[model samples]
Target: MQFVILCKDKPDGLDLRMATRQVHLDYLKDVGGANLLGAGPFLDDQDRPTGSMLIVEFPSEAEARSFAQNDPYAKAGLFVDVEIRRWRWGVKPPAA
Candidate 1:
């Protein structure tokens, strides 16, 4: 199954996000179960990062949620709120 991982950063937590970005990316790269289809910081009205949005694919919703829970960003307390929604990918050709 695919899941949309919507993460809203804690207030003024951009520093934390930047600090753990490398580890976060590494974790995602090594987990090997979920696929990070698309992800980026959610910009506020002033064009500052207020949160994140990620589209991931896994074998099950549980797995996807697990990935989100164990993500380095979550562990670092960068997220004020996070949401996981089962997703359907009806776009064009899949990523190569």
Candidate 2:
């Protein structure tokens, strides 16, 4: 199954995020495989990063959720909120 891991940073979390970025990237590298589809930071109104989004595929929901829970940013308490949800890639037609 595929999961979308969404995290929202606390207002003052930029420092924590920046400090933990290398570890986080390293963790991603350790876990990356065919299942690790994509990941990136989310920017705020002023273009400062405020959160993160990770797309991953795993055998089950438990594994996916576990993956999110173990992220370095998450472990460092950089996020105010985190959400992990099942997802699927599908075709979407353009709006009229």
Candidate 3:
């Protein structure tokens, strides 16, 4: 199944997010691999990242939660909230 992981950064967390970004990317690449459908940061009006959104495939919600909890940004305490939910791609899904 596909899951969406929405992460909200803590207030004043830009510095920590930047510092941990590379490691976080690496972790996503390492673990998410083909299951990582898409991922990116959520930007504010000033075009600064304030959070993240990731869509990934996992057999169960438990595995998806585990993936979210193990993210470098999560480990570094950059997020104030993280929400994971089942997702449906209603438009322009990749060609099979």
Candidate 1 displacement at residue 47 in angstroms: 3.5
By TM-score rank, best first, the candidates go 3, 2, 1
lDDT of 2: 0.88
Best by TM-score: 3
CA shift at 84, candidate 2, in angstroms?
0.8
lDDT of 1 by residue, 1-96 (tens): 778999999998989988999998888788733488877788988988888788898888888888898999999999989999998988784767
Can you write out model 3's per-residue Cα lDDT over 1-96, one digit (the tens) per residue? 999999999999999999999999999999989889999999999999999999999999999999999999999999999999999899999887
Best by lDDT: 3
**What's the lDDT for residue 82 in model 2?**
92
lDDT of each: 0.86, 0.88, 0.96
Model 2, poorest ten-residue lDDT window?
87-96
Write one digit per residue (lDDT tens) for candidate 2, span 57-77: 899988988888888999999
Query: What local lDDT does model 2 show for residue 74?
Result: 90
Q: What 10-residue stretch in candidate 3 is worst by lDDT?
A: 87-96
Query: How close to the true structure is residue 53 of candidate 3, measured as C-alpha lDDT?
Result: 98
What is the lDDT for 26 in model 2? 88
